[model samples]
Target: MAAEGKINPMHQFTINQIGPKLEIAGYNISFTNSALWMVLALVVIWLFMLGGMKRELVPGRWQMAVEGVTGFIRNMIDTNIGPEGRRYTPYLFSLFTFILISNLLGMLPLAIVPGFHAFTTTSHFSITGLLALMSFAIVLVVGFWRHGFHFFALFLPKGTPAFMVPVIIPIEIISFLVRPFSLLLRLFVAMISGHILMEVFSSFIVNGLGSSSAIGFGVSLLSFVFIVGIGALEILVCALQAYVFALLTSLYLNDAINLH
Candidate 1:
C-alpha cells in the first residue's frame, strides 16, 4: 500500500520504457530505463579507461585513479588464480568497474532534480543473473576446453574415500550448480534491500514532516538521521558487493584452472 504524496520504495526498481515500445518477431525489444543505464555504465567505463591511456611519466589524478583500480584487480587475480590469471584481468576489471560504477550511480540523488531519477540495474535479478551466468559460462568453457571430460572430476575431491563417492559427488555437484544463483542473489538482494530501506525512511521523513504535531517533527528528525546513516552504509555496500562478486568470480575460475 502507498500513502498519498509519498513515493513507494519499490518504485525505484520499476522498469519503464524510454521511448515507443516495439515488437519484432514476437519479441518485445523496446528500449527501457534499465537498458539506458547499462549503456550509460558502459560509456562511463570506457571514459574511465581512457584515463590510463595517457601513459605519462607523472600521472595525473585521472590516470592514477585508473591505474589504482587496474592494479587492484590485477593483484586480486594474481593472488587468487596465479600467473595464468593475468589473462583474465581485462574481463574481471571491466566486471568490477561496471558493477561498482552502476551501484554508485544508483545512489546519486538525481530524484532531487525533477524528472530525473537514479536507477540501480543490479537490483534486478535479470541483470545480475546474466552477469553470473556469463562468468559461469566462462568457467565451463575453460574447464572443458582445457581438461575435456576431466572437468567432471571437479565434483570429487582428491582425498575422498571410495565408499563416500556417491554422497560427496552429489553434494559437490549441487554446490557447483548453485554458484550462479548465489552470485545473482547476493548482489540483487543487497542492492534492492539498501535502496528499499532508504526509500522507506525517505517516505517517513516526508510524511512526518507534513504533520503539525511535535511527535511528527521528532519522527521526521529521527528518520532523517537514519537516512543519513543508511546512505553512508549503502555507499560501502556498493563497493563491497562489487569486490565480493569479482573475488568470487576469480575464485571460481581458479577452481576451473587449477582443478583444486
Candidate 2:
C-alpha cells in the first residue's frame, strides 16, 4: 500500500515529453526528457573539449581534466589492446565521458522545477544496448578484416582433439555470441538499479517529513542518511561501470584482432 500511494518511487523513471510531441507512422518521435539529457551530455563534452584545447603554458582546470581523462583512457587502450589500439581511442573516450556524465546528471535535483526535466540516459536499455551492439560490430569488422576466414577460427582454438571439436566449438561460439547481451545487461541494469534505489529513499524522505508522527521524523532522518551513503556508492558505481565497459570493449577488440 505504501508503495502504491502518491509517493510512488518508480515515477522517477517515467520519460515525459519536453516540448511539442511529434510522431511519424508507427513511431514515437517526440522530443523527450531522454533526448534532452543526451543533447546536454553531448554539449557538455563538446564544450569541455573546446575549453581543454586552450594553449597556455599552464593548463586551466578544464584542460587538465581533459588531459587526465584522455591519458587515463589512453593507458587503458594501450594496456588492453596494445599500441595498435591507439587508433580506436576516440570511440572509447567518448563512450566513457558520455556514460559518466549521463549517470552523474541523473542524480541532479533539477527536475523539481515544473517545466524543467532531467533523465538518466543510461538507465534505458535502448541507449546502452545500441552502444554494446556497435562495439560488437566493430569487433566483427576488425576480426574479419584482419584475419579473413581465419577469423572464424576463433570459434575453435588452435588445437583440439578432432572429436572434442564438436563440443568445444559450439561452447566458444555461444559465449562469443552472448558478449553484447552481457554488456548491455550489466550497464543498463546497474544504472537503473542505482537510480531506483535512490528514488525510493527520496520518496521515503518526502513521505516521512510530511507525516505528523515522531517516528516519521526519525524515519526521514534515517532516509536522508541512507541517501547520502547510497549517493557516495552510486558515484563510485558511475565511474566504475564506465571504466568496466570500456575495458571490456578493449578486450573484445583485442580478441577480434588476435582471436584470444
Candidate 3:
C-alpha cells in the first residue's frame, strides 16, 4: 500500500527551521526555504537590472528584453493609474519582476528539490503573506502620506445619505481590512495548488508502473506529457497573478486619492 502517513501537500510549503537555533522572543529563528527563495529572487533582479542598465546605444539583446519588461510595467501603471500614479512605477515594477522570477525559478526541475530534498520556497504561505503585507503597507503609507487624515475619508464615500453612512462605513472598513487577506490567500492557494497537482500526477505515473504488469510505461509517458502542459499553464498563471496583485494595488491607491 502507499505510505499510510504521507505528508500533507499543504504542509510541504510551510516555513520551518533548517538547523538548531534559538530566539530571544521565544520564536524559532532559522534558515528556511522561503528565505533562500527571497535571496534568489533578489539576486535575479540585481543581475537582470545590471545587465539592462548598461545603456548601450545599439542595445544588446539582453538589454532590449529587460527594457521590454520595464516598459510593459510602465505602461500598465500609466494606463491604469494615470500620470498621477507614475510615482509608484518603481515599486510595481520591482514587485512584478520579483514574483515573475520567483515563480519561474520554482518551475525549474532542479528547484523542485534543493540541497538534499528541501521543500520548495514557493509553496510557503509565510513568504507569500509577507509579500502581500508589503504591498498592503505601501498602499496604507502612501495614501496617508499624500492625503493625511483625509485618507480616512476613503472608507466613507462622499455624499452618502446620513442614515446609510453607518451601514456603508462599516462594510467599507471590513473590506479594506480584508485586502491583505485576499492578496495573501490568492497567491498562496494558486501556487500551492499548481505544485501539488503536479506532484500527485507525477507520483501516479511512478506508482502505476511499479504496481502493474500492463503497459504502464505508456501511462507514465502520457502523464509526463500532461505535466509539461500544466507547467506551461502555470507560467501564464504566475504572470497573471502578479499582474492582478499590482492592478489591485493601483486601484486601491487610486481610490484613496479619490480619482474614482
Candidate 4:
C-alpha cells in the first residue's frame, strides 16, 4: 500500500486473487493477477495472429503486419540455427510474440481506472524462470535426442590442451549451467528496474503536486517530463528485452542442434 500523498510503484506488481480461493490437497492453485495477464496476453496474441490467418492472395495491413513479424523471427532463426531451425519456428514465434505482448501490456496506463492497474508478469522471476526453463528443456531434449552422449562435447569446445581438460571442463560445465539463470535474470532485471524507476518518478510528481510552493510545482512539472522520457525508453526496453530473450533462445537451440 502507498503512504498518504505518495505512490507505491511496487504496488502495481502485486498479485491478487481474481476469484474464489482454490486449493488442491496441500497446494494453493488460486488464480492471480499475474495469471490473468498471462491469459490476456495469450488472447491478444491469438487475436493478432487471427488477423493474418486468411492467407489472402494480396495481403492487407493486418496480414502484412503479421507476416513482417513472422518473417523477422524466421530470418533470425535461419541466421542463427540454419535450416534445421525452420522446424522450430512455431515454438519460437509463439515465444517471441508472447514475451513482446506481455512486456508491452505492463506499460499500459490502465491505472487511471480505480482499483485497476497494469501488471508486468515478465518482471517476476518465477515467470521468466519458467520460460527460461522451458527453453532450456527443449534444448536439452533436442541435443540428447539427436546426438546422444555426444551432446556432452558442447562443453569441450574445438581445441584445448589435454592438461587444461580438467580446468576447462569444469568451467564450461558451470557456464552451460548458467544459461537459464542468465536468461531469466536478464529479462526480470531489465523489466523490474524500468518500472521501479518510473514509479519513483511518479511518486515525486504526486508529492510535488500536493505541495503549495512554486518549487514544488516546478518539480512536479519536471517529474512529468522525466516520466514521459522514461516511458518512451521503457517502450524501447520492452521490445529490446523480448528480442534479446528470443535471440538468446534461438542461439541456445543452435548449440543443441549444431553443437557449436
Best model number under TM-score: 4
TM-score of each: 0.97, 0.93, 0.86, 0.98
- Residue range 76-104, candidate 2, lDDT tens digits: 98998899999999999998899999888
What does candidate 4's lDDT look like per residue over 23-135, in tens digits? 99978899999999999999999999999989999999999999999999999999999988999999899989999999999999998888888999999999999999999
Q: Write the per-residue lDDT of candidate 3 for residues 95-188, one digit (tens) a residue.
A: 8887777877777776344433334454567767887888888888877887898888888887889999989999999999999888888877
Q: Per-residue alpha-carbon lDDT of model 1 for 166-229, expressed as tens digits?
A: 8999999999999999999999999999999999998888889889779999999999999999
- Arrange candidates by TM-score, descending: 4, 1, 2, 3
Candidate 3 global TM-score: 0.86
**Alpha-carbon RMSD of each model:** 1.3, 2.2, 3.0, 0.9
Candidate 1: 10-residue stretch with minimal lDDT: 1-10
- Each model's lDDT comes to 0.93, 0.88, 0.77, 0.93
| Stretch of 10 with least lDDT, candidate 3 | 111-120
Clashing pairs in 3: none
Instruction: Give candidate 2's whole-model lDDT.
Output: 0.88
